[model samples]
Target: MAGRVGVVAVAQTKFEEKKATEHTAELMYNVTREVMGQTGLEFKEDGTGIDATLAASYDLFSGPAGAYMFLGYVVGAYRREDERVLEDGSLAVYYGAMQILSGHVDTVLLVSYNKESSVGKNLIEWVGMDQIYQRRIGLDFVSAAGLQAMRYTTKYGITPEQCAKVVVKSHRNAANNPYAMCCDNITVEDVLRSTMLCDPIRVQEAKPTPVDGACAIILASEEKARKITDKPVWITGFGSCYDHHELGYRDLADCEALTTAAQRAYKMAGITNPLKTFDLAEISEQYAYQELLWSEGLGFCGKGEGGKLIDSGKTQMGGDLPINPSGGMLSGLPVCVAGMQRVAECVVQLRGEAGDRQVPGAKKAVAHGVDGPAGQLQCVITLEN
Candidate 1:
């Protein structure tokens, strides 16, 4: 076997409107403590001595540069000189899992949280813009997504009403999610009548921001995972890829990165037909249209057919394929932690502990993550029973 990885434990805070003003490192340390406590791995013994340690986090939402500095101190890793920190929290968790799978570390801790309540909503887009090619034109994530959605609709011939249905379903499903930021039931008509943030994209269609939350997951090798917990969610496949950064450089209607990433994941997992192989999906749907876009990108549906698939109710909780049963990003966008939560949610579903939102008889699932404007970065993971 090349390498094996599994999630051993996970913990999260209730999504709040505002973060409690705790230092970014403090929040991460608490989440880390929760994960260690649950797994009983804080005091590992290896031949009469504890082994090495690994950790990572991002500083974007921490309101400080190198927020991990404080986190390392709180976690008792400050004295060690070998600990590594990746600035991007999502990438941090990605690397944490990689370390365990590659045999570099037997145990790894992945932590990510954000105080998004304090930053401007469009901060990422503003920073992602190129000063010479894309800045000063007032372009942000909303506008970029609006452009993508507009092009998707124009190419696929989807109507705004069709898009609103996604929001309607998301809210309906989110009502049962205790950690969801938006749990209120909303109708398609309500979504269409809601405030229009961008043409063809209403306020309800876009994910509301400023969600304060923290989450972490512990990962270990296959043998270690089996010994740690009775219920271990195996990571059968993991793949990530990046598209061209410039908006005009890639196709606005579809995601090439998604297709490539999914291929790698499916190959690793030995999956032939995704719709027939996977039981549920936790995709990065920042907007309703993205669900449609990604469904096609992931081969759940063909081009210009996602709308029809949704209309047929094939993706509902009890339908042939359940998508976003955790309410997805449509219910909450906790910034850095959102992607890892997708992975954790899939693990939760596979472990049969998803509570009311669990997918019945679900054995395999997919978790998708995206970053930057125009959907520049993408990651996909496939899990199986």
Candidate 2:
């Protein structure tokens, strides 16, 4: 792709249960400062610093009418080009990349923040559902995920033990990640014996740890990227899709939206075989079973074979196609910031800067994120060094 938009620098706060001292604006400022400091760029209109800014935040979660009002001061968007995205933070990256590709900006600053502990998480999530039908049934992300997990496991004959393995792997991998919140060494037995939140979804198997964090990334045009950093992670391909809105109308076992999104990304990246093409994947596995389900959706394996893929040990750290070397979303990234963290992890690996969790000689990577009920909306981004 010509006029490539490359990730030159990325920054993120340590995932924690609560950022007690820092407010949402402070969190955003911290990450933005780090990225700007890394690039030695300022917010100016004379083509000397970031040409534009993109931010992501939810008004309900941030407890403000216009959440971007808090970020504009930190991102230095007072009199510059700035826009707010109401979806996942990864969408900012997608939109920023498009702006660069359109020859409108040389450098774009992207930032996203979420403090899950500051609000009633359930109330915020419930508001996003279909108020007429899904909202009254008492379904949030967890219950919706449970519904998908039960269906996927039942149809594919995936056992509870298989799902437990995903949790074990996530925590084990997170041990090397200083920014991850859940890095405890756990076993499949521990997972199986943990509290059961819903049928087939154990407390450990679900997002066991909720976190508060912020992430920022600097995207530059091909010309400016080479000057900003020698190891620029290029955004080669990206795509997003939306599935059925209502849970009753959709097939929970198959992630048609995710598959279509991945296929669109793979086609743009000239990747014919995803299983052998990318060195690693950073998936937003909101639940233990999602790792297996999303692996199938990403075409790492055939349909209903996610369990076989796990059993093959191919997704292990030293295995053929390692998945979530940074422990992924299971390690406790904030809800809206989850996908942006995946993109940051990919940038770290592609730059050969992941100190302990580095994938050796990794040149290409895929990062995924989903929103809405039961993975209704999906986004896939492919990056290369």
Candidate 3:
């Protein structure tokens, strides 16, 4: 907390429907190799290279409780201090920053990825519920999200058309992101007319495909960061919170967890006004309606004003503050990796490396992610050039 934790390098693979040709280890190695190559750092334990390694992933998604052992070797963690963040990927960055800020490590490597296509043995979403309660009630993320969508939209007067606009914008923005999954142009009419999966939430409004991808980032303290790169992106602030697990306990219309987590990060970053404080935002939206709900939670607008925010085109690529210029989670990011992708995108943007989706003169950005049923858990990280 004294100096600063900075992200000196980052890399990610093109998110796609499947990566059957490559194993998960390959994904990890590819990104780790690229990121380390960018910084000229190795796994030397002599205090001159990466001091620790962190992997952001979920054991459930990988189908083995102790999978990190096999992964550790692939990411150059052989006999090195390697740990895993079982929640959303953004938290790994949070944990890595803390490691450096605590003076326990000078440099860290974070690799986050999950092949959604390989999760065939279990229903990752449904299995997340309690066995005796929610599971018996038959609730998966889609249906549960549907319940939230109806409650949020009805309570806030957010029209289904307004939610559809999110899908149109996501796909359109994905075109600018070469690492994005297969993207096709779509319209609000197209989203509204698409297959209705959960009443107001249409098929087109959800992540179009299960994607396999990996993202890697190298983090260092201020002293090492300056030596690694002239354009180091600093991790100025961070926060995470988990709400009540039971759907019955929460008000489906509002996400208090997201607001609390965001407020903590904003306070640390001295962000009194999110819309004016940051030039852009990368939010993890599993569904289109979530983008609206999360924007409000992030304090982009007043309560019940999320619908107006999206409808105004204020969150577009060329708007006052672009939201998801790199196509966000709705484009195809898997759950665990989605939040980390948001952070990686922010690093790219702040480094002036995001080619077509770049936000001009973007000195600041926020990356967000959520887990659990209906955003029960939330994470926020603020980054700056």
Candidate 4:
């Protein structure tokens, strides 16, 4: 597919487990400033620069109402147009592309941040659930993921050892990443020995909490993209979908939302066989099992074949298709920032800039993101050189 939107510049700050020194504005500036410098672009009144600003952050995590408003000012959008999404970085970039596709803007500035240390994760997610049933039982993301894991494992014959491999691969890959947070050279036995946060979900399997980070990206129309940078990572296709909010209403073992979203994106990008179409992937897997579960939803394998896929050694470094060469969210990317960083990592790989963990001749890549208990909402973004 000939792309209409392209990402000309992308930047991200080193993610930390607890970055208490900087405020949200500082985090925004840290990345936005770098991106602007890369492109030498600004918010011009004559419509030659960034015409729209898109941010991925929520009032819950931000700790204040209209947090995006102040963030916009810090990025030189004081009185200019700005928008916000209560989703992940992939969705924000998805909307930014829409801004250009809709003829609303030729250029868009995308930003995403989450200071997880500022607030408690469980309480925040709990409040978002149904007050009468789900929240009353103290169901948060971790616990919810446990329920899903139980069903997925039991139904598909997936083992804890298979799930443990994901953590091992993620941290090992992260060891080579300069911006990732968790990069211990741990093994599968170490993961099985780690404390269990939720039944069937070990502490090591989940992303270490209280993380803080931010990312910024510049999206431009095909015409403006060529003028902004000689090399542009084109946004070939994207899609998103929402599942039933109640756990009882949906199949915990299946990622229906992700399947629909991937189908939509694949259709737009003319992808008939995902495992063959994508040279690499950067998926937001907050937990180890998600890498397996989400991969099936992405059409990399048949349903219930995630365990077999991992055992095939086809997704590791130097494999036919690598998933998350930049260490991924499992390597410490913040919630709101992971999706965009995935896209950024893909841009770097596509540009031949990924120093050590680069996939040879990577041209087409997929970046995925999701939110809510048991993966209630899902989004997929496909990119190419």
Q: How much lDDT does each candidate structure score?
A: 0.76, 0.89, 0.89, 0.89
After superposition on all C-alphas, the RMSD of every candidate to the true structure, in Å, is 2.3, 1.1, 1.1, 1.2
Name the regions of candidate 4 deviating beyond 4 angstroms: 1-3
Separate clash counts for every candidate: 0, 0, 0, 0
Q: Clashes in model 1: which pairs?
A: none
Q: Candidate 3 residues 1-385, lDDT tens each?
A: 6699999999999898889999898998999999999999998969999999999887766768777767778887788898789888999999999999999899999999898888751378898888898888788777888999999999989998899888888888989999998467888888888888888788888876578989999999999999999999999899989999887788889989999999999999999999988899999999999999999899999878988998788999999889999888888887788888899999999988899999998999999988888898899999999
Q: What tens digits encode model 2's per-residue C-alpha lDDT throughout 1-385?
A: 4578899999999999988898888899999999999999888879978999988877788887686785577877788898888888777888889899989889999988889888877788788888888888888877888899899999999999989999999999999999989998899999999998888999888774548999999999999999988889999999889898888788899999999999999998899899899999999998999999999999999999999998899999988889999998887888879888899999999999998999999999999988877899899999999
Please give the lDDT score for candidate 2: 0.89
Reference-based lDDT, residue 317, model 3: 93
Better of 1 and 3 by TM-score: 3
Judge candidate 3 at residue 276 and give its lDDT: 85
Q: Per-residue alpha-carbon lDDT of model 4 for 277-353, expressed as tens digits?
A: 88899999999999999999999999999988888888889887798988887889888788889999999999988
Model 3 misplaced stretches (Cα beyond 4 Å): none
Q: Please state the error at residue 246 of candidate 2 in Å.
A: 0.5
